[model samples]
Structures are given as structure tokens and as C-alpha cells.
Target: MAWNEPGGGNNKGPKDPWGGGDQGPPDLDEALQKLQEKLGGIFGGKSGSGGSGGGGGPAFSAPLLGVLALGAAVVWGLMGFYQIDEQERAVVLRFGKYLETVQPGLQWNPPLVDEVIKVNTTKVRAASFREIMLTQDENIVEVNMSVQYVINDPDKFVLKVRDPEISLQHAAQSALRHVVGDTGMDLVLTEGRAKIASDVQTRLQEYLNLYETGILVSKVNVDDSKPPSQVQAAFDDVIKAREDEERVKNEAQAYANGIVPEARGGAQRQIEEANAYKEQVIANAQGEADRFSKLLAEYRKAPEVTRERLYLDAIQNVYGNTSKVMVDVEGGNNMMYLPLDKLAEQSQQRAVRAPSLDSNTLREITNMVTEQLRRDAAASGSTSRRGGR
Candidate 1:
């Protein structure tokens, strides 16, 4: 029936699974022999028989040991292999001490002997700060700043500082406070924010370098700079007033820009017109002077004839514009009345209508009138004398 059941089947006391009939306890030596044989087979070594005469029990063969050692070495080497991404760097430490920094890609180092710490070198990490700081003018201002940084040196980042990000945060706060303290409140709350941000970045980088944090401050942004909430309304009113002042100044400047140009243009035009008038008057005066010089030459040649001609020309000019004429007869009781105005008008009208009636014809008619006047004077038995040489 059962393998361990007594009497009926075998006539033996009980069959021991270990060896034969004696079941006091399984033999320790026999158990050790079985375990050795299985292990030897796995390692490609000969197994010893389960007997005392089986030489030195389970001795290791040289070839089997060599294969085992090689397998162990291969497993250790595989454990040392690691891969790093493009944006990452690895810092290797040997025996818990700083060893070397490794670049990205497949890398291998002795496992359990050298420790590898990976850091993302190209990643841009940010730390923001908002704190109340006193300005140089002893005014309170709320400064909100954000610092962006990256791990430039993986070795220093891992070994030099226990916590690089925390160090960077502290450094940023110190730098921001220092910069804000050195600046006036007006600048911190207005256009001066950009300059303050720049200064903070520079100062923060210096601190990181000083601490060997291996962090590069890429950018610093100063967001909203404002007065505290207790005085926000007052600050807004001030800002509005400042803006109004600026707007008024701009309007005045624009008006001046428009009016000044127009005024200058008008002045320039007047100056040019006056110069033209001056040139015209000067040219006319010069021409009159030349005519007078020529007339003077003619007068010097014949004094009486030139003087009589001048007097006749003056009389013709005077009579040309008059509508009525009254001549005093020499040694006569009544004045002589001549319809000279009507005759001059008729002559002027005939000259305008006829092309043949020119200035020469009008001059001949004037000579005929002068001869008639002389006859009339001769009839009066007197000659007319002119005054004012």
C-alpha cells in the first residue's frame, strides 16, 4: 500500500527512504554526498560516490572554477553598466569619495566600487522669491523675483554642495535683498526693476560660484514691484498723477512742435518776399540813376534846346491825365478855355481801336496842339515864360 507502511508487503521493519532498513535518522554523510554530486554536475565537475573511499569529497576542478569565476565577473560587469540621456550628466564616486564626472550616453563603472549620481545638466530649473525688502530710501517695497538656473557642473553639483537647489534659493534671496537695499524705492517699483533683476542675477551667480554649487543662473525676472497693501491706493494715486504730468508735457511738446514749425515757415516766407522786394527796388533805383546820367550828358550838349524839350515833355505828361484845362492868356482880360480833355480822350479811344494810330501819331497830334497854342499866344501879343529851373 503505502511506501512507509509496516509488515504485510515487505517483512522488513520499515523501508527507510535514505538507505535501507535502519531508520534511526538519515545519514548526514550520505546527504552531504548527494548535495555535492548535484552541485558538481551543475559546475561541470565529477561527482564523488556516496562512500568513504570516494577520494577527497567533492573537490573543485580547475576548469569548473575558471568557468564559475568568469561567470561571476560577467555578472558584475553587467551590473556596472548604465545609460544616461542627452540632457543628463553622471558624477562617479569611488569608495564614497569624489572620482570623476561622466558625460551622457552608455557608461560603465565598477559596481559596488564606484557610485554614479546622475544630474540633468541642460534642464532649466526655476526658483521664485517674494519678500518685503527695504529700499535705499528707507521705503518698504514688495519684490517678486524668479531665478532660472541650470546645472553646469555635475561633479560640483553632487560633491561640493549637499543640496544645490536650496543653496541657490538662499543665494538668490541674499542677492535680491542686497540689490533692493542698494536701490531707491521709486526705481524698484518702476523702470528700475529691470536693472535690479540684472544685478540680482549677477550677484546670485557670484554666490553660487563662491559656494561651488555648480549652478549657472540663466535668467532673472522681476515681476510686479509694488508698495505694500497698506499704501497701494496712495501709490496708485501718485502713479496716476505722474502719468497725467507726462501726458500734459507730451501735449505741450506736440503743440510746440506744430506751432514752431508753422511760425518758422511764415517767417522764412516773409524774409524771402522782403528780399525780393528789396532787390526789385534796388534795380529800379539803379535804372533811374543810369537814365538820369544819360539825360545829364544830353543837357550838357545843348542847354537851351534840352531845357525847352524837358519843359514840353513835362507839360505833356501833366496834361495827359487831366479831364479839364484852363490856360491864362498873356496880356488878355479873359482866360482861354480849351476842350483839351475831351480831345485827348477821343484820341486815346481812336488809338485803341485802330492799329495804325500808334504812339508816334499821338506825338504828332500833340506837336500840332503846341503850334496852335503858340499862334494863340502870338495873337495875344505875348510869349509865356516858365519858372522853376
Candidate 2:
């Protein structure tokens, strides 16, 4: 029989056999009522009252309470232990005071007593700043820059300053402005941007170190540095003019490089030509002098024959241009038709007299005279025939 079923208890059995006399069965309600009265009296409450005001209400009460306490403890322990990622660091604070720092992986702290703030110390942090300042030359210029950093010391990061990020930003701005103010505009725009970034980074690091912020600056980059937009056009014009000047200078140098060598080569060629002409002239003059000396020696050996040969050569040189007739003018008007006066003038200029005639000279002169008469007779015959016609 089941425990909750009706008449399922020990009273359901037959009446006791040991008692042969009339032993009646006990009343089930009376038995239950006396048992309830005894239990109620033991717990210091009224019998048959089903209220929670009675004490010692159920069995295993202490054990249940113990089990509940154990569960609560387990939950609290679970809440105390936490894990930090590889890129994070935990800053523990005990009762509003710094306690210790925890590295990555599973960590434990007392619950409700200690607070852990996990900061990504390994993550690279970046900040940008911009400003305008007067240079050493009293020109105002604007500079924009960025800085990348990481937290290397968690203790100093949590304890040193109220807000490390804000402090670092301010420090960076102050350093940049200070550096820009100390330099000139030309340097800032051209060669000094790198130097400026370096200087600002150095100053920022110094300030951060002084403040114990534990931020390590990794890189400083100069984004843009220039004159203000209002004067930007004027600055551009200046830069353009400078570039134009450089280009013009380079072009002039290129032209010189091209032309100078050609000019030099031409000059050298002319000089060589002149030198060759001088050498030819010198050689011709030397040859003429040697020939004249040889002629003078030959002339001294035979004066008459040399004079005759020279006269013949002179006559050939003078009369080589045209036909000419030579006549003796000692007899007056021997050849009236011929121009004797002009012939005499030419002979005086030549400084040579006609040869005197002897027997042999006379025969040669007679032959020359006979040939001239025959040529004159033929010319007169042709003229007479043309005139008759």
C-alpha cells in the first residue's frame, strides 16, 4: 500500500490475536488526534493548526539551510574570480584605495571588497592636436599633428593622474605650440616638420614622465603644416615663383651645356685651318727663296745666255695673252700703218731694245718680212673682192 492511500497504515491489519477477549479496534481519528496533540505540545503550539506560527515545522530543516548557505558561497566565489584578456590589465582597488595590479588570465579578488578596473594596456592609443603660433620671424602658422602611445605601467596609469589621456593631450598641444613658436615659418613648412614632431614628442615624454602617467609615446607624425587659408594663395604664388626661378636656371645650364662644347669645337677647327694656311705659306716662301738662290748662282756662271733666256722668258710671259708683231723703228716711219709710238712706249716700259741685225739676223728678219708681206697680200685680195661685191 502506498503511504498516501486511505487505511494504508498499521491499523488496517486484523485485530490483535493475542487479546482473545473482546478487544475492539481503536478509533482512527482518536489515534491521529492524540498523535497530533503530542507533536503540537512538543513544538509549543496548538494541535491540528496548519500554520507556520508553529516551530520545528519540518524534518531535515538544518540540513536544507546548510545546503542553501553552500550554494550562496559557491555563487560568491564564482563572482569573485574573473578572467582578463591578453591585451588587458586589471587595476584592483580595495575600499577605494589601490590594492594591486593583475596580469592577464584567471584572477581572484574578494567579492564586494575589491574592485577591478580592466584597462587595455597593450592597445595602441592615438591622439591628434592642432594649433597656430607665432614663429621666430613673427609669422603665424598652423600645425596639425598626431601621436600614438600605449600604457606600459598600469600602476602609474591608475594612480598618477586623474585623467591620463587628457593630460597627455594637453601636454602634446603645449609642446607643439612651444616648438612651433620657437621655429621660423619656412623651416616649419619645409625642412623643420620632422624636427618639430621630434621636439614635441620629446617634450611630451618629459612631461609625462614628470607626471608619472606611464604612457609610452610610440610615434609622432606631422599631418600638415602650412600658412592659414587666408594667406594660402600668397604662399602658393611665392612657392611657384621659386620653382619657376629654379626651372629657368636649369634651362640656362642645359643650354650652356649643349652649346659650349659645339662652340669650342668650331673654334678649334678654325684654328687648325689657320695653322694649315700658315704652314703652306711658310713652305711656299721657303721654296721660292731656294729657287731664287739657285737662279742667282746659274746667272753668275753665264751672263749673256742667262740674259737671253730671261729675255725670252719675259717676252713669252708678256705676249702669251695675244698675237703681236715686232718691227725695227730705227728707220723713220718704216711701218706707218702700225702704231710705232705705242710700240715704243711698251718697249720703254719693258726696258728692252730690238736686236741688231747681221747676216744671220738679216736672213731671219727677211723671212719674217716676206711672211708678213704674203699675209698682207692675201688680206688685200679678200677685201677687194668684198668691196667689188
Question: How much lDDT does each candidate structure score?
Answer: 0.86, 0.81
Which segments of candidate 2 are over 4 A away from where they belong? 1-65, 260-389
Task: State the lDDT of candidate 2 residue by residue for 192-213, as single tens digits.
Answer: 8899889988999999999999
RMSD of each candidate relative to the true structure: 9.4, 17.6
Give the range of the ten consecutive residues with the poorest summed lDDT in model 1. Answer: 380-389
Deviation (Å) of 18 in candidate 1: 27
- For model 1, how does the per-residue alpha-carbon lDDT over 36-66 read when each residue is reduced to its tens digit? 7778778676875546525435457987778
Q: Tell me the lDDT of candidate 1.
A: 0.86
- List runs of model 1 lying over 4 Å from the truth: 1-75, 312-389
Q: For this target, which candidate reaches the highest TM-score against the unseen true structure?
A: 1
